[model samples]
Target: MSLDFKPGAFSDFFRDETFRESFTYRNSPDAIRRFPFPFDRDEYMYSVNMEPHVPGRKGSVFEKTFDVDEHYVSEMIDRAKVLADDPLRCQSLPHMTLAGWDTLELIMEAKARDYPQWFSLTKEGDRWHWINRPLGIDHTFTFLDESTLPYGPFEYIMRQTQGDWTLQDERDGTLWLDAGVATSQADWSADFDIGMNFHEWHAPVPLAHDLGVFDRALKFLLKLQHGSPVRRFNWTMTVNPLLDTSPENYPKWGPTKTTLTQENLGRKQHLRVELQSLYRLPRSNAIAFDIRCYLGSFEQIVTVPKWGRRLHRIVRDLHPDLATYKGFIRNRPAMAEWLSKYDDGAPTSPGWWPED
Candidate 1:
C-alpha cells in the first residue's frame, strides 16, 4: 500500500491532526480494525510475552519492521512540539554516539525498504543520501559523521520516526539506559531514567518484578543476536488521544482524567498500547528499544465485537495493584461498567485478531 506523502499534496494516506490541545486525533476505520489489542484472552497479567519481530499478515501493524500508518505525519509533528518544549526529552550520552548511528542506519534501511515510495536511501561506502518525502527531508552526509546532521544521529532520525526509543548499552552484565527519546511515553520520565541499569529503570513497574519477568527478559535480551529482534506489548489507559503523556508535563494532562463520565467515556477514554521491539545493533552491541504507541478510543475499539467483549472482561477483572500502577484505578470501575454494555456474554475467539 503506497502512500502519497509528497509535500503539500493532500491525501487520506497521511492525516492532518493534533495530539495536544483541542485534541483532534482519531483512528480511521482501517486503523481500528488493526488496533493492537493486547489481551489474548479475557484477563490480563504482566509477563515476558516476547515474540519474534517478523512480518505478519498484510494490512496489520505487524506487516512491517516499523509500522507507518496514517498517524505518521501528525505524530511526528506532536513529537517535534514535545521536544521544542523540553529538549531533555531526547538525550544521548557521549559514549552512545556509535549506537545512535547504528539506530539511524536500522530505521533508514527498514523504512526505505518497506516504504520505498515515501522514503529512499542510497549509500556509497560511508557517504549516504537519504530522503523522507513526508517530513520534507533530503540530505546527503557521511554515515558516521555527527557534524553532518542537525541533531545527533539518534535524535535526527527519531524526530522523523514515530515512537519513543531508548538505546541501552550493555556492560557489567546489565543493560544501561544511557540514551533515549521519550516524548510520547506513558507516564515515565526519560530524564530521571537515564543512566539507570535494567532493573533500576524497571523498578517502578508493579507485579513484574516479583514475577521475575524482567530478570528473564534481561537475560534473554543480553543474548539477543544481531538480525534477530524481539517484540512485546505494554499498555495503559489515557483520558484522551494526547500523545505527550510524560510525567514532567503531568500537571497539564493529569487534571483531564477527572473529566470522564459514562456519557463521554467512549469517546475520551483511550487504550494506549506500546508495541515495544528490541534490537541488537551489529557494531555497537547496544540494544535499541523501540516503544511504538498506538491509541484507540473505547468507541473505536468496541466497533469490533471480539475486542469489545474481551476488553470488558479484562477491565472488570484486572487486579487493583496493576490498575493503580497504570494510573487508571480511579476510572477502572467506570471503564468496566461502560464496556460491559458491549459485551453480550458471548464466547470470543482465541487470539488478538478481530477477523478470526
Candidate 2:
C-alpha cells in the first residue's frame, strides 16, 4: 500500500532528521502513499509509555495521524462549531494540570535539548508555521498491560487507520492498527465569554485551512480567547478507558459500544469508540466524549460532571516567562509583525473577530 499525498505540504515536518524517530516504511520506502491515489498507504505506529510524572501509572499509546481530505476537514470543523454558542461544541477537549503542562513542555524541550535542529520542527517559529498552524500540541502517552482492566484500551477497528497496539492475548503475535486521529490543517479559534446569561463560548475561529498554518494560528487564537491577566495554571489529568481488546476480558473500559445506523456507517470498516477530550474551563473543567467510529465517519457526543470551584491553583512567576513559556509572546515586535493584517490579524479596537 502507498500514501500519495501533496509532497509540498509535508516538506516542513519532513526535514533532515534521525531515521530512528521516523518510520518511512519497513521493506518499501514508498509504503505510505498519498493523493488521488488508490491503495492502503503508509500508517504511523508509535508506542508511548504514559507514566513519566504520574506516581504509579503505566499504559500504551498507539496512534495514526492523517489529514482529512481538505474538503472533509472543513466540513468537520463546520460541524464542530455549527452553533458556536452551544456549550457542547466550544468546550476544550483536553484539560491538563500545571504539572502536565510542565511535562509536556519538558518533553518538547528535551527534543530541542537533544536535537536543536529538530527543535524548530517540533516547536513553532519556522517557515511552515509562517503559512500553516499547529494543533494537538500536547501529547501524553503510556502503556497498558493486562492489569489496568477498567482503564485499558480506548477503542479499536480491525481495518482502520487508528487502533491500539497490543500483544495478542495468547501472547502469540502483535496486534496493531493504523488510524487517522487528527490534523492541524486549519485555524481553530475559541474564547470564553460572559454574555447576558451564564458564561458563553465563542468558537468562530476558522478551523480549516492548510495544516501548515495551524501552529501559528493556535498560539495566537488560544491567548486571545482563553488567556487572562488573572488566569492561573493548574495540573490535572482525567483518565477514561473506552476500548478493551485484551483477551482477559477484564472489567476495563465500561462504556458500551455506540452503534450507528447502517446509513451513517459509510464504509464496511465501522467501529464505535468512546474517547473523551479533557479541557480546563474558566468555571469548570470538562471531559467531552464522542462515540466516534471509522476515525472520522461520525461521532456521538457525551460528557462528564464539571470540575467545580475549589481546585488548588499553582502560582507561577508568569510575567516575563510568558514569552519563554505561555501567557504572552516575549517578542512583542515579532508578535505585532505577525498580526499586522487586521482582517485576520491582531487585536484592533474591536478585537479580532469571526465572519458573521
Candidate 3:
C-alpha cells in the first residue's frame, strides 16, 4: 500500500524530527527491517557490481523506480535548508537545461505512477499538471518552459525528491558531470566536480583506479540506452545520521567523529548506504544519476541477528585503507567492540536478506 501523511494523522516522530542541530533522525522498526544492507558477504570491497533496476521484493527499496518512505518529508526539508545555506549545492551548466527537464519528467512520472495516492501528474499536450501532496506543491507548467517554474527544472523537481541527483552529459566518448544537486552526499562536492569528466571526478578513490573498476564502469555507462536503468550500492560510515556530509562543511561535523564512545557508539555511529541508479534520459541523452542515501544506526541494525554477526566480521576484518577512506578508522575499533556483543560467531546465511 502507498503511504499517506495527511494533516493531524502524521506521526509525531516525523513531525518533530530533525537531522541537524539536535539530530533527532532515526528509523522506525519497520524501516530498519527494510534497510538496504550493502554487504552480501562477510567482507567488503569496491567493484562494478551493478544490476538492472527492476522491481524487487514487494516492500523493498528496489520495489519502485524511486523509493519514498517515512523519511521523505524530513529529507526534503533538510535539503531545502542545505540549499538555502549554500546555493552552489545545485548547479546546471548552460548545455544541461534540456537535461534538467528530462530529469524532472523522469522523477515526476515515476512518482506519480508508483504512488498515485500521494502524487499525480496529468499531461495535456505540452502543458502539465503536477501535484505533490507530501510537500504541499501543486502547479501547472508548460513542459520545457523555464519561465513556468520557480527554479530550473532540475532544481525544481529535485527539491521535492529524496537523494542527491547528478545529470551527466555524454560527449567525446565520456560522461561529464555538468549538473547536480548534492545536499546529502558522502564527503563529495558537486560544485567542485561540476565540469569534471568520469575519471577526473573519480580520481580520488583509492585502489579503484588500479583495479580498473572505473575504466570498466565508464565503458559500460557510455553504452547505456534509454528506457533501461541500472543500479548499484555504495556505503560508508557516518556519525549521527547526518546526511549533509559534504567536505565543504566538514569543520562543522568533523569533531563529532572523536565523540563516539562505548556508551554512545551504538546510537551515534551509523552505516550510510547509497543506492546509486543511472538512468539514460530520453530527450537530452544525458544520464540522470540518483544517489539515494540510507542511514541505519548500530543500535537499530543489531536488532537483526544475521546483520549483527556479519557487520562485526566486516568491520573487524576491513582493510586499513578502506577504513581511513570511509572516515571511520579512528572509531573502527570501538565499533567492532560494540558490535561484538551482538555477534556470537555464528555463520550468517549467504545473502543480505533479513530472512536469511
Candidate 4:
C-alpha cells in the first residue's frame, strides 16, 4: 500500500542503525541508554502489535530493532510482577491500561541519537515536570527496495496509530465492559498495551464513595465485558490507519485533535487467563479485583467484588429508560449462569416490574 507521508517525511537522521549494528555485530554490545528509555537487545524487533487497545491499527511493520538490555528486562518483569500482585492495578481503565508503562511498539518510537546523555534538554511545562529532551533517537525512515537486494533494509519513521481494548472477567466468567479508541501522537506520545480488566468481588466491607469516583466506577462497569483472556479473545479488525496531517509529508493528517474517524466494525479480540491478586488494603482492605486491560482506557479500581452473579439492567444505545446495566451488574453471576438465564428471550423487565 502507498504510504501517505509527505516529502522529506523520512529524511535519514533517526538513530544509529549503522553504528549500533556494527558494534553489536562486531563486539556484541549489550545495552544502550536511549533517552526516555533504556532498552535491551531482545526488545528490539522488526514489527510490533499494540499491546493495549485496538487491533489492525497495529502500526506499520518495522524492519528495525528496539534493543533492550538485561536491566530493562529486569525492570519490565519487576513492573509486571507488581501489577500482577495487585488486583486493582489490572483494572481496565484509560489511565490505568498500559499507559506510562510500556513503549508503544509503533505509535511512539522516539530513540536517542546515541545515548540519553548526549541529547539536548529543555523544559516544556511546569518546573517539576520533565523538560522536553531529545529521546536520542531520530525517526527518519526510508522505504525499502525489496527487488534490488530481495530484502532491502528499512528504517524508523515517526508515525501515528490508533488503538483500543475490550476486557472480560476471569473469576465470574462475564464480560464487564467494552472500551475502544482511535489516537495519533507525536513526541511525548505514548502507547501502553496493558492486559487490564475487572472482576466481581464480594468485599468483606463496603467503602465510602464520593460522587466523582462513584460515577466513574459505574461508568467503568457499564460496557459489555465479553473478553476471556489475551489468548481467547474475539472481535473484528479495523485495519485502515487514519490519514490526516502528519509530520512526514502529510502534516495535514497531523491529527486535528478535534474530530476522529469512526469505526465499530473489524475489531479483533484476544483473551488470556492468569492468576491475580484481587484485594485492596487501603480502603478497608476488603475484597477487590485486579482488572487490567491492554487498551488505554480501562484501569485498576477497588469495588465491592461482584462474583457468581451478574446484574440484569438492560443496555440501550439510545436514551432507553434503564439506560445502563445496573440490574445486570447488581445481580452479578458467573458467566455461564447469566447466559442460561438470558437464553430463552430477555424477560424485557426486571422480575417485579415492567423493564420496558
Go through the candidates in order and give the clash count of each.
Answer: 0, 49, 0, 98
lDDT per residue as tens, model 4, 1-356: 22222222212222221111121111111111111110111111111111222222111111112222222212222223322343222233443222211222121322232224322222233111111122222222221222321111111111111112222222242323322221211111111222323322211112313224333443443321322111111111011122111123223332222222222111111011111112111212112222211211000000101100111121111122111111112112221232233334332221211111
Work out candidate 2's RMSD over C-alphas: 26.3
The 10-residue segment of model 4 with minimum total lDDT is: 296-305
Number of clashing pairs, model 3?
Answer: 0
For each candidate, what is the lDDT?
0.92, 0.20, 0.91, 0.20
Q: Residue 61 error for model 2, in Å?
A: 10
Q: Pick the candidate with the highest TM-score.
A: 1
Error of 3 at 32 (Å): 0.7
Better of 1 and 2 by TM-score: 1
Please write out the lDDT profile of model 1 over residues 225-343, one tens digit for every residue. 99999999999999999898999989999999999999999999999999999999988999999999999999999999999999999999999999999999999999999999999
lDDT of 3 by residue, 1-356 (tens): 11122333345433446789889888988888899999899998889999999899998999999999898888888888898899999999999999999999999999999999889999999999998887667789999999888888998988888999999999999999999999999999999999999999999888889999999999999988888899999999999889999999999999999999999999999999999999999999999999999999999999999999999999999989889998898899999999999999888889899987
Shift of residue 316 alpha carbon in model 1, Å: 0.4
The TM-score values for the models, in the order shown, are 0.97, 0.20, 0.96, 0.18
Tens-place lDDT per residue, model 2, 1-356, is 11111223223333321111131111111111111110111111111111112111111111111222222222233223332323221221232222222222323343334334323223233211101121112222322221321211221110111111111010112111111122111111222121111111112222222332334432332332111111111111111111212212223211112322233322211112222211122322111111121111111110000100000010112123322322222322322232222123222222111110
In order, what is each prediction's RMSD in angstroms? 2.8, 26.3, 3.1, 22.0
Query: Which model is ahead, 1 or 4, in terms of TM-score?
Result: 1
TM-score head-to-head 3 vs 4, winner = 3
- Sequence-dependent TM-score of model 1: 0.97
How many clashes in candidate 1?
0
As a whole number from 0 to 100, the lDDT of residue 189 in candidate 1 is 86
- Indicate the residue-level lDDT of 337 in model 3: 96
Task: Name the runs in model 1 displaced over 4 angstroms.
Answer: 1-7
**2 versus 3: better TM-score goes to:** 3
Q: Lowest-scoring 10 consecutive residues by lDDT in candidate 3?
A: 1-10
